[model samples]
Target: MEINHKIKDQITGFIAANSLVLIVMAITKYFLPPFGGGNVIIFSEFVILPFLMGIVSAWCWRKINISTRKQSAWTIYNTVIAIVLSFLVLKEGMICLVIVSPLLFAFILLGTYAGKAMFKRNNQTLNASVFVMLFGIFIADSLSVHRYENKVADTITVNAPPTEVWKYVVAYKRIEKKSDFWLFRMGMPSPVQSTAEGYYLGAKRKCIFSNGYVFDEKIVTYDENKDLTFDITNQPRDPEIMGHIDILRGQFLLKDNGNGTTRLTGNSWYRLYVFPVWYYDIWAESVTRNVHLRVMEHIKELAEAK
Candidate 1:
């Protein structure tokens, strides 16, 4: 028997059958914290919109009357897909989320709706299952989190002096103008507009995504010619069920290689306590380190060209 298929069946069935659990779990995940954290966030942490989805799903599994065997087989197959997608999500964050979120949601719906007659053939059952899975993500993310960390360093010897690089870093807006959202992505202009002054501590700026998602960035440190760090100090507009996720951090360090070369390093750290992650930090660091260096190279090109 394919264990993979069975896992999918269970996820779908559980979601379709346990709507109440999903609702409760969603609320729990959205609001509860790991142990030590600030409550500048009152009931500030919300999860209701998420759980209602589950309430709808459980109703579907029962109404559809999906067979136990089929549910098991499908779930097993989906588990394999879920595992692969989980690793990708941990590694790539929003990039992976954009892709996996849709596929997983689609399959989950399929498992919930396609298997009818086990409980009772009802169209509402299909609708309910979709809500159940959406709600469960809230609970699942709250209950367990898989995290990992990665560290990376890059050495780039700019012909220019460290002070020169610092100036360019300070004037990043000049290096590359912020790109606008394509017409297809969002109906609105790229909301890269923010009052956050560049390279200054406490500077704040707003960034809008193609999905109408919005977050604001705030500078935490502005060490001249040495290090620059900032944090996105707001909650995700897309999934407003959870507490403020602005706890995440990002850093850029410029070190003199003691030679003509300079070492410019970058790091990013973000996590959901409930998610079990052993090395997401490492993975994120590796990816962002190069990403920053590349940005530095572009800066170098611009500065040199002038």
Candidate 2:
């Protein structure tokens, strides 16, 4: 009877601890200022969120008198629950969330251990000091300079010639198979259609997104059968989704493989003005690479079809 009662207590503590973590995240994301901004990701989502989860887990373990063997279960439970809540409830992008998942889990573990230490010592001064240190770091991170440009290039050798490839390069049809890559399933925008006006320099082309986001590019350098380079003039204006990123420019270079084939190299350069560029870069790099590959593969399919 005593064993069963202890198990029940442990389960209850787990639920309550994770619930508190979810609620805190909700408050930080929704009820806070700068809604849908990078600040939310940096200060609230990454740092404080994990810290709270850690603290809660530690508190629960100590309170419930859970066995050492069962203690690790609480950490895993907390992380999985938080991820689900972030996706379904918070409406965060799956790719970024998953990219940062390891970091968040680490934070939970650190916080849990910290929580254990705090409870063991039961010293208010120690608690106060640690809180101050974390707050200072968060403040510093907010004011820190974190602007960077991430460039991603993907190459595919197409069996068709440059002329055939160039036709598909400037513009192509919608990507019918949305499930070709994991990024597409994770909400990364798939290339719908690219349409260019005129064939000379200064021509404008627009690559449309499935969600109505359009990347407007102006041709700066146009080599008939070699390279097509364009500078981004207009970007998607969706504040809730596309506001954090600014796509700068994109280029497609066609190189002769000398074997009746062409090597298509796609390049994109974008600046992320958000703070803590390193953390966000993980998501940005993955997203850009996937986005590039999807388009390149789509072009390859169309070029090879002819």
Candidate 3:
């Protein structure tokens, strides 16, 4: 079996160059340790970025010189995509691995061709290629998850002072409603009232979703004019159900935006989710935010109207 030696050399050289930088970054991360004052520094970010760039740069060079550059370009593109995808999956951790695998495979053909071309009989090259392949995939997924971890932030601005709106907004039994913007067509209404086990922490609250999907939430944290967050324990382990695709961390936060407006942020923090990582989240978040934003706007309008 004959391989295009020149193209093969380019791929190997690219890997060598990137790997050297990655090793240096890793060592630097180990010594410098991105840790101080409660924040865990993401050492991997510093490492994978250079490698991703190197792969892209190699693709550019190959695009001009190598006849199989088209394949190489796709390979590099997929590698970059893999990095982005890995970050997303890594954040989800448990369930997201199921998703990240297929994405990494998209580049498998090109990657293998390049790798095999580079290493004819060297066992070390084969091992190194495998190591880098796995490492790159993992780094990409980790970064994806990290990026998504803090993506959704919902804010609430109440017209009145905190003392006034805090009572109603933080109340356990208050009936919620949609703001005008959330009126998709305006016929049926969302289930606003749910029975509360208790108004404070460690107590359970029964929340009913739009289509009879039931969720049980424990009040994890409750504070006045600061934050109210709940730990949702979804009822029944049925994945086939469409109404409640995920029962994530449901939370409410209140902050002073200066002046008289009280900012309230409601969020449905993601926990466990399955593959096609982008689609479900995009769909679910749209509804969650659409509904919540409308509700918050109504609160604002109502508060201001008075």
Candidate 4:
């Protein structure tokens, strides 16, 4: 009977800890400002909140007399549950969730270890003080402003001269070739065609993607076969992932190699609203590079064709 009673207590503690973690997540999301524009992904969401959830889980386990040896496994299990719940309840895209999983797991584990150390002496004062400090940090982080801008460029050597490449750079027909980019294959938008209303500055340009989404661009700088630059006047609104990023400008620079070939370089400037710029920037750069390559490759094919 004692063994059964102990098992029941463990189960009860597990349930309570998980419930508290979910509640904390919901409350934190409610209080934090929405991502993008004036709001950004703060440290609290990726770091502090997971840490607090770990501590809360440890507290519940300690109250139910769970052994220290088993706390690590229990904490991991609790975090997995919480993540699954977030995916279901929040309706987050799989790509976004996958990208964030590593950070969440790492911080939660650190918090669990910290909690273990704090509870060893069973000091309520220390625990309360730490909680207060964490809360203060969260508040301060929320009130601060964070904006990040990044640039990515891709260069390709085309078999044609600057004049031939320049024709396609201004505007091109539909790309009939299938995209080989992994992200585009997985449903991320890929460029399909581009059209220009005029051949001079202030011309209206439209770059259409496979998903029927079009990027509205205005020609800011036009230098015949040498340089073409445009500002993104409008972007697609349908894709949920697009909400976290804004593309500011795009440019194509054509240089004559003087050996019957041209060097085509594509440049883009964008702002990312996601947190931990170091991590997401890699993805952003990769996606942008692939987009540039895809478009430039199509231009190469057309320009080189007899």
Tell me the tens digit of each residue's lDDT in model 4 across 21-69. 6676566568645533353566676788788767765665554566655
Off by over 4 Å in 4: 1-37, 63-84
lDDT of 1 by residue, 1-306 (tens): 556655454466454433443344345436656422431211111223213322334334443334656554554444344435334532323443432344344444453444343235446666577557755664554444333333345556566556667766544542234433232232322332223456577887544433455556777889987887778687463332132222366566777767654566656565432222222233334334544555567656655555
Q: Which stretches of candidate 3 lie over 4 Å from their true place?
A: 1-151, 172-191, 235-244, 301-306
Q: Rate the local accuracy (lDDT) of all candidates.
A: 0.46, 0.75, 0.51, 0.80
Tens digits of per-residue lDDT for model 2, 1-306: 877866665666557766876775566556755433454345445766577667766765665565545556667777777788778776666665676677777777778778888977889898888878876775565454455677888888999999989998887888877656676675666677888897789999999987777888899988987999999998875543454578899999999888989999999998774435667777777778878888888899998999
Task: Give the Å error, residue 176, model 2.
Answer: 2.8
Number of the candidate with higher TM-score, 3 or 4: 4
lDDT of 1 at 200: 75
lDDT of 1: 0.46
Q: What's the lDDT for candidate 3?
A: 0.51
Give Cα distance to truth, residue 139, candidate 3, Å: 21
Lowest summed lDDT window (length 10), candidate 3: 34-43
What are the TM-scores, per candidate, against the unseen true structure? 0.45, 0.77, 0.43, 0.83
Instruction: For residue 298, give model 2's deviation from the true position in Å.
Output: 2.6
Candidate 2 Cα outliers beyond 4 Å, as residue runs: 1-40, 80-100, 123-125, 211-213, 237-240, 273-279
- The candidate maximizing TM-score is 4
Question: What are the RMSD figures for all models against the true structure?
Answer: 11.2, 4.0, 11.7, 3.4
